[model samples]
Target: MSFDSANLERAAAWLAQIARQRLTARAGQLVETDLGAFDYYEDGSWLAHLLRRHQPSGEEFGILMLALSPHICPHLLDTVIAEVRPEGGELPELGGVRAAGHRAMLPTGETAQFFFSGMNMSRRFDIEGMFLADHWFARDRILWLESVREGEPLMSGRLIVNPEIIEELVTGKIGRPAFSMDFPAEHIETAMDWDDLVLNPLTRAQIREIEHWVKHNDTLMDDWGMRKRVKPGYRALFYGPPGTGKTLTAMLLGKHTGKDVFRVDLSRVVSKYIGETEKNLSRLFDKAENKNWILFFDEADALFSKRTDVRDAHDKYANQEVAYLLQRIEGYNGLVILASNQRANIDDAFVRRLQAIIPFPMPQQEERYEIWRRTFPEQIALAGDVDWRQIAARHELTGANILNVTHFCAIEALAKQTREVDLRCLEEAIKREYVKEGRVM
Candidate 1:
């Protein structure tokens, strides 16, 4: 007593009727909406599905349209619909809500029997009741209720979906809307030239490498075998003193790659309750599929600390958490950057996973000079007598401190009613920095 044939026949007969009624409507009104287009797409069943979702008075009005499918009697579907119209523009429940198919509601929540001709497949996180497709936005993604693997042949063979391909489609280091379906206005990105933007103060070569990777990571991943292989990505560790452009480099990389750079908000990921942190991270990855994102964990050492000799439950659970994180990170398909001021705090196992450990050493004398010469824009006028070289040499501060001193000098020089920065004003800025750092400059 296979219901498969009976169910499909009932559903097909239902859809053929819909096509005939739509034809009677004034031209150019049909096929105007996602629902309309979907109803008309290969079969009108999709519209039937939507109607079932809303469950309005005349589910049969939409159900009748399904008759248009080649296999159904279109004329009979139209006849049934014409016979049931309420004269006073009234709405009522159509009889025979039941079909000879699967025990599914017709989107009407009316316990209407639905025949599913196609197979539906989805994964659950066993413990967490989350959908794998939750990682995608509905507008940008096209989700098929049934598996297309057994369906008609395509330009490429039947588009059989496997976990490998879906996972590839779901994970990214940087991303723009899962292959460019119209995204929301809020998600749309505004373009900026990382190189031409004057406000950024990162080094040319380092910035260029980040940019090149952003622009050509497809080639890199393919060459490195990360595309098809199950390997943890070669990590790139960024180490430096605070406020010296490490964060800026990461953000610029996201801008270059056409995706959002998310600073993994630690508050959201870390929890006081045991095993909660791992679960939180799992949800984050589930929601981040294929949107080539730059995930920045600013202070990575909190999670990547060295393993300890276990004596208590706390110690064992902590080690388990680390192990779980390593597994998830290895499987992650996007760009991963961990930034920290104290590199020594990160465990060797974590360090070994890194592909590039770029040390952001404090700027040298010449680099510091460029930092000064370029820091003040041409919009602001300075006296020709002001010496940038003297400032860079005398300050001997980190690049960030130099920027601060330059900022103060600009304010002070302007207030003195002079366009040119005076030696005295610059000296005052240097003195303040010396006091803050407790240096004998």
Candidate 2:
């Protein structure tokens, strides 16, 4: 559903009512108030959908609104502050902190406690329960309380709503995170379909198994009552030479399954500083934990290679990073694909844990022929002299090689002001590919 301003307005009103009541109570007025009177789950809003899906308790719902208040309506609380202390001073009881960029005060955990529990010891303890490590609030990554200074009350921490949640509520869609230091994976997708992929029957069958896991893993784990016995998520190792279908297969899997594919850049993921690598990986995995994303770690051998004997601190830490990676990937609840040029490059620890190890070897002659025939679009015509079967047999080019040749030929055809690609152009393109790869014609 689209952003519903009316529902947000209603929620803001409810928050304002509660805030005013709390402020009035602090001023020696015992005003009767029923916090449950407002509809926390209004029909048709993104927040409402989340509320319905999670079904958080009344206290939990109150905390969520308090966390979301600044983003939606900052002035609402500022006005409450003005009313309570018109002389303009900090209201410690209302609990908030000033941000350099944010003009108004942002709520803290203490704010939520003050708004909901109002100094009642029992109620405050319940609010504290919601922020515990295992609570859905933190586990689902919906919201959390920021860390406080040493020895300070935990309630003093600033309340933080997940940025994705805020984006979804405001724009009615969750924004895909961009590639950065924190999130080093880039989103990848393919316009090509399964029909365009060329693989041997055995390899194709292995891929199909991965597809089955993606489609029915929840059933296997939950519906079949195997959750206790089996581990969460699927792990696969895609080993192959360059230009084989390893990466393309990953993209196609996501395309066919309707899931996002994120290729982790190992250069960015492996930090030189001790413990930094795990932190970088943790940021990536934490964001992806509930996203059901297919994480493609291309050239994964750089990170997942066999460990060496610890001769130094660096060696010890490197091995530790690999162990940490193994534990994290095993615990992930979605598909994790580690692609490398060779299977032997990966550590045995990762291999033994893999559910599937599919190889993308160099395409055989028949597969190469199919690839050549399928590379060109229907808009481009092949000259009568062009022979795909002969070329496919002679060159032994990969699917990617054929595609590169097709692209070169197509561009040449367009340059020559014609819709047709001739045998000469095709031969020249193939020669270029061979030259680029330092291979003999």
Cα lDDT of model 2 overall?
0.87
Error of 2 at 282 (Å): 1.9
TM-score of each: 0.57, 0.90
Question: In model 1, which runs have C-alpha deviations exceeding 4 angstroms?
Answer: 1-114, 117-210, 219-226, 230-234, 383-385, 438-440
Error of 2 at 36 (Å): 3.6
Q: Rate residue 143 of model 1 by lDDT.
A: 24
Per-model C-alpha RMSD: 13.6, 2.8
The most accurate candidate by lDDT is: 2
Question: Per-residue alpha-carbon lDDT of model 1 for 219-240, expressed as tens digits?
Answer: 7667767666545333577887
